[model samples]
Target: MTPRTPAPGSVTEATCTRCQILKPAAAFYANPLTRKGLHSRCIECMKDVGALRREVPKTTAAEATCNVCGWLKPSSEFHVNRRRFNGLTNRCRACAQDYYQAKRRGIIEYQRQHRWEDARVRMASDARRRDRKHGRESDIKAKDIVIPRACPVTGKPIYHGYGVRMAWSPCLERIDKSKGFVKGNWRVVSWEAVEASGWQLTRT
Candidate 1:
């Protein structure tokens, strides 16, 4: 027997053989070959087909090209992208790195030659700003603070200088050698008030 056709604008109900559920004609695809009119597969099957379509590869041979080198390569060589072009960078990665390094070196050389005076001025300004931030009393205390130490290598008096310190010491080896005496073969003698020490030369 031939299936009955629903009137125009009327709803026709069909059962999905796979899902075993009855739905309206809107829920199934139109099957031109089947007189029943509605597709055997249901909405769930259509959704699965859509998902598979999204997962399928869409790249073609003509799509793969490097923007920098203008070289035509395979899709594997290029970087991947979800929205736009994918595959490796247009210029090879090595060329990109070298370009950046050269630019950096040029900047360093320029700064080295021109920045010394500017750096000194900046340092002085920073010191003054730090002093102002800490207050004048802190600056005075720092200036007056004496570091109690002679030279670490030679036990000699350290003198205070303008915002700095200095150390003074005589080289015993040099003094002995100047007097025609070996460094290790020097004799120790005490000079009394009545006896004058061997012609001593004070360091000017």
Candidate 2:
């Protein structure tokens, strides 16, 4: 007797209205407005139509050319951009991801290089480092250090974050050479002030 049911891939196959390629019905998107309840074109062909309608070459109308890689790939490989005529970004998703990652790294580096560190934090860290270098570790924390707007010793304005120490840059120094980072013995002063007062600099 003849088989009662049709074999798979023989029936229920869909032909994309735009690409005109025969594909499985599962390839199309559900569309309540259509009689067949599915989009006329397959998912890829629907994306390709968006690019082709933007005045791209007809020969490659079914695919979009990545502006970065210059490779012709299915439009699905690109990210959507409502501002663009083609509704897709110039670069494919892979290339776009790489570009964004690099951009994020640059932004982080710029922030690190340009943003000011807290004056108290800088002084406190330097004190700890100096103490360690001289075999004299202290219990001083970052909060224990206080940085004033102007140097008390020389009465000069202190500046921060020009990427390097300036004459007006703040410096952490001991009020007495015999005391090393002792509570109430250390003060923030301008680099120039430290020089004028003949104070011993914190040796590395």
Candidate 3:
């Protein structure tokens, strides 16, 4: 006579050699080789086997090398916690810095020569657009202040293009507040006159 299989709702006891306990048949794995009976090992043992199957051999520092500069660097230089590209940087630190500096200089020179006018127009349009979008007052204001007619100190005809109003003079280090070098006070002077006046330029 053939043996009857356990019913779905009924429980069958099975012994685990590892845990040394008599557990329900559900706690062990089904083994076709043992007449479809529960295996001697429990579910926890199967999980440990699965973990061993998925583990990889760790690479040592001797196996790692920098892609750029062809240097055999330590594995510590690369981060292993990353999930992509075997956790390695494409370029070494020195090579990466050189690449960035070259790219930056190229961009700066190109923008300085080619994009000044277009950039200025775009910036003005963007400011106006932002003001309209947010319903805020635009800060663009007109300056109607008069240009100094004569060199206040030198008493000479200050060249329109070479003097203060024409050329840009950065703010000085020390302001002569008592001598009226405050707001709404400006004067045109020659470079020699400025030097003779002993005014020091701010380092910025």
Candidate 4:
């Protein structure tokens, strides 16, 4: 038999397939792909079904399949997820690690490519890291540091960028390596001045 199609904007009522009861169309969730443009089951029935599915324990053997890589591996290879009855993630450890590493590399590359846009932020971050690494009670404030328009030593205009080599970029220098990144202990100096002073910037 052909299904009765309700006129548009007049679907005030529908039937829940799960509960086998007539109910308001608003009780069902919208589903554009369905014929009626609404779920056959009411929202309450759907919620009950979801709760039942969550309660049902998943069966797992000593080996499990990684949903991502489609590879069968030992259950120990997956991370634990309390929500799952099997207590293991669908993705194996190797696949999860690879995914995270790729995500991290992409972020690093993005930051490196946009370094010029965030030079001042990077300078402050570096200072804070240095302070923490040295166990110093000093703080680095972006507002406190003044970037000079020109190199203090050479009287040349200062430049800031990611691709700009250290020899031409603005650099944060510590007057004394033993000192922390305190207000009086650090200075914004050109990389050329640092090299002229026989000091090389240390890689963190």
- Where model 4 places Cα greater than 4 Å from the true spot, the runs are 1-16, 19-47, 53-61, 84-87, 117-189, 192-204
How far residue 92's Cα lies from its native spot in candidate 3, in Å, is: 0.9
* Tens digit of per-residue lDDT, candidate 4, span 35-82: 777788888898899897788456555778999999989988988775
Model 3: per-residue Cα lDDT over 1-204, one tens digit each: 122345686548777777778877777776656754667677877678777666554543333566667887766565453333344566656667788899999987886544433433443454345445656444421231222435555555433322232322211221332222223333334444566656443111
Model 1 TM-score, 2 decimals? 0.25
In terms of lDDT, which candidate is stronger, 3 or 4?
A: 4
Question: All candidates' TM-scores?
Answer: 0.25, 0.49, 0.28, 0.40
**Compared to the true structure, candidate 4 yields what TM-score?**
0.40
What's the candidate order when arranged by decreasing TM-score? 2, 4, 3, 1
What lDDT would candidate 1 get against the real structure?
A: 0.46
**Residue 46, candidate 4: alpha-carbon lDDT:** 88
Cα RMSD for candidate 3? 15.6
- Top TM-score hit: 2
Candidate 4 collision pairs: none
lDDT of 1 by residue, 72-178 (tens): 76655655554343423564444466778999999987875444334334433443454455442112222222233343333444332223212231111113323
lDDT of 3: 0.50
